[model samples]
Target: MPVPDPEVRVTAVDPHVSLRTQEGARATPPRLRDVVMAYVGLTKPRIIELLLLTTVPVMFLAQRGVPPLGLVVATVVGGTLSAGSANALNCVYDADIDERMRRTRRRALPRHLVSQRAALVFGLMLGVVSTVMLGLLVNWLSAGLALAANVFYVVGYTMILKRRTTQNIVWGGAAGCFPALIGWTAVTGELAWAPVVLFLVVFFWTPPHFWALAIRYREDYAAAEVPMLPVVAGARTVARQITGYSYVMVATSLLLWPVAGTGWFYPTVAVVLGAAFLVESHLLLRRAAVSDDVVDLKPMRLFHWSNMYLSLLFVGVALDPLLTR
Candidate 1:
């Protein structure tokens, strides 16, 4: 049975008492540390880490060696705030369905650790601060791009696309790609084909990365009425799409080698990493071919590997300039 929204009260034997009223009466005020952690949780730090991973490496590549220490620090700080703002706003909008989904039920809003209004205000504040910081410390172009990405993730992905379509993560995921552009522009103060190539690489990588997790949480999304690809489509179909996008992502990663005119080290690393990514994606397809069950599918294997693949691949990106020099 589906869980009822928390706002709805269940009647008790006395009729005058309710489950929520009793629970509220029993609840104690949250401790200071717990309150601080709850606000931090709204930012989704792990996701921000991944965004920054793509960021700093591109800055290295753009510089063709070490980027200035001050610029790197400023860009990272501004990027963190910008990404945090988008995520916090996303939590505010998704709080209703988040309560119904098992995977997201423990988030701050669903757990009632923070009020919706407080989260909304906090998100807006972060965005404004990040934009101003980036404009002043980094560059106005980087700030503008970061602000655009923040708006797109919150308004475009979270509000418009997520609940409405199966292709939600495909287009919505573009917001995550901005860090590449931001990283490059922070170094050069302008856009170029090299960063755009990295942008496309992340673009194609998002679906496969996110869908693998969605496959694991298919039931939760169904319960929440979100139309993630795994929820509406068959396991085999979703796996096939994952495989297809994996090929394109690998191809795009290679484009950076030529577009940036990097040394042989980058392409060699890209090839090895791309091969492993393909193998894992195909393994998921093979598993889906046999059984539709989540247990049998073991989609998390690909999910976990995808994280390493992107991280190591970008590590190669950062290493190439130094090694070649």
Candidate 2:
């Protein structure tokens, strides 16, 4: 008070100025809508949608017609939560690599919109809630299967296999196959050969389906140091592998018809769809063989078609029972 220090000199605050505003600028709290959307983005909703497509159709197949609306709803809800948990945990674990990849750089964690600790807690919460909800509303078997899938995806795939092996998605993909079993058990309370066949269908389908996307992002994967097939193998080699797996996937799909005792309609659809899938895969192989260029490879064509292939194939599964009935 005796003398003002030159370094510490300050101007008097205006009486009209609010004390909060006078305390230096504070960051605007994130908008509520933005916060909600960020959390939803963390769950990777589109992947969950694809997983549910596999799930509900199997429930319909298991019931051999329309399942109870309540049971269907509960199973779907639990499955979504479980898948979300797995995906969120995956995003958290992969955040470091994600920031390095152009395709994944925009995700919440990489963008700094959400903290890793918060995401981890959210993922674990979803897993617990899904398990409890399924056990209470559906059946314990389904709940157990969902929990197993979550563990396999988070621990088996994300942590253990993703970065270390080119064959990572091949075996780790079994996590996705669990939905077929979960859907079947939700209705029948036991596993069967039919769902097992469908499980194999998805298991074989995984490599080709994911490798196509990897073809498009080979550089991103190389930059991230991941050993995806495309990152380590020549385009022709990856394409050949894709075509081979496509053959196995189609063959496995047909097994479901005989194993589940489905009628003419299901097999007919399976044949048509399988033929189309084979054609597309072979086209991808031909393209890769002829050209090393990603643009010429046109990998996304197969990527997009694979999504439709699985969705429509499962659609066939759902409609088979109702149509045959």
Specify the highest-TM-score model's number: 1
Question: What are the runs in model 2 whose C-alpha is more than 4 Å off?
Answer: 1-27
Instruction: Compute each candidate's TM-score over C-alphas.
Output: 0.93, 0.91
Please write out the lDDT profile of model 1 over residues 1-325, one tens digit for every residue. 0001111122222322332343364257878898899999888887888899999999999999999999999999999999889888989999987767655666788767889999999999999999999999999999999999998888888889999999998999899899999999999999999999989998898899889988988877887899999999999999999999999999999999879999988999999999999999999999999999999999988888888998998999999999987
lDDT value for candidate 1?
Answer: 0.87
lDDT of 2: 0.84
Model 2, position 161: C-alpha lDDT score: 91
Candidate 2, residues 48-144, lDDT tens digits: the string is 7778888899999999999999999999999999988888888899888876666666567865668899999999999999999999999999999
Model 1: lowest-lDDT 10 consecutive positions: 1-10
Runs with alpha carbons beyond 4 Å of true place in candidate 1: 1-26
Clashes of 1: 0
lDDT of 2 at 164: 96
